[model samples]
Target: MSRVILFNKPYDVLSQFTDRNSPSPRATLSDYVQVPHVYPAGRLDRDSEGLLLLTDDGRLQARIADPKFKAPKTYLVQVEGIPDDNALAALRGGVSLKDGPTRPAEVERIDDPALWPRDPPIRVRLSIPDSWLRLTIREGRNRQVRRMTAAVGHPTLRLIRWRIADWTLADIAPGRWRDA
Candidate 1:
């Protein structure tokens, strides 16, 4: 991507610059990014947060956003409960979704990333234990990581996209960005 910017999108913020459909004003990319003409390459759900690529080049945007490119997107996922080997295998092997079966993913259980405190913390259940997973997929499906985790009986509580293609969030803090 040319004139690319790697932004660490915060939770509850829309990927687009404008929120024309929202009845009330909500946090959007415009609130964080002021570089003119640079648009988000792909979307990070308002509920999910982390690395979002913005580029002035349209071709770069397509390459990063398109599933056909198979650009690997890695996530640090916090799930409702610890996953077992079988569940992880299911994710690694690919699961059937409403859209279709997913491509086999690279997934593994992980310890807490402890990056930033989400503005409004994810709800915690006193009895149910929570765990983390590092998952990487090539497709940019709607809520795919969350859906995949849920499909294996471990609903994701907090999802963070840490890397896309060869780019990574690295030291970028929440709501901050750097040109790449």
Candidate 2:
């Protein structure tokens, strides 16, 4: 049987297990995880944090990360400004980024009570209020959420991926991992 592991990656950590010459210091999976032969299914940027799936089966990893599969990924986005209905609708309908037009997503404004605080809090403009948004997309483009939010006039201050398909970050704290 193939093994799937869910890791709640902490902020500023590289997605890869090994990095000999990273520009900045980071905590990698090799430091905390002891599972051998398992590799990450998809990559989360160094700045972004949350659920990262690792698997020993290469085929299973491809299936989960491939855009053709259309596996939904849900993100809890903290934006610099509250998104209006039109903006939210635009995200649901689809938004054009530098790469191309993205697939329509499932988006909603949410009052999330279980959000964990970041080690270094997001910068606040004070005059501009921040709001939380729940965004789900089938495509896993690079920095897609940040670009999409920026296109819609509400730049993402912080982004935490909460779920990927049937898997989630439920009860997982930063820098933790568990077998799925």
Candidate 3:
């Protein structure tokens, strides 16, 4: 059987095992995960945090990362401003992006989730209100959640990948991993 590992990627961490191309040292999977031969199934941007899957099996990686498979990924987003109803409706209807129109997404505003604090907390703007959102998308795109929210005029302040496919961050702590 192939080994699958679920990691709660911390912010500013590179998804790979090494930092070959950069001059300055950056934290990577090697800093956290010790299991060898496993590769990340999908990528989460260095600035974003939460659930990331790794496996020694290539086919399972493809199934999780490939757009054709349509594996759903859910995010908890903290936005710069409160999104109005029109913005929510527009997101639900799919907004046009530089690449193209995105697939319609399931989105709703939510209360702030009770979770571990980010090492470097997000910026707080007392003058401008911020809000939380639960967004689920079937396709994975480069920084799609951030871009999508920006398209609707509310920039993402922080983003966390709460779930992917049937797997979730659950009890995994920052920079920690668990076998599935």
Can you list the residue pairs that collide in candidate 1? Answer: none
Stretches of candidate 1 exceeding 4 Å from the true structure:
none
lDDT of 1 by residue, 1-180 (tens): 379999999999999999999799999999999999899998999999999999999998999999999999999999998999999999999999999999999999887877889989999999999999999999989999999999999999999999998899999999999998
Please give the lDDT score at residue 121 for candidate 2. Answer: 78
Pick the lDDT winner.
3
TM-score of each: 0.98, 0.96, 0.98
Q: What's the CA error at residue 73 for candidate 2, in Å?
A: 0.4
Cα-based lDDT for every prediction: 0.95, 0.91, 0.95
**Candidate 2 lDDT for residue 119:** 82
lDDT of 1 at 71: 97
Q: Taking the tens digit of each residue's C-alpha lDDT, what string does model 3 give over 88-114?
A: 999999999999999999999999899
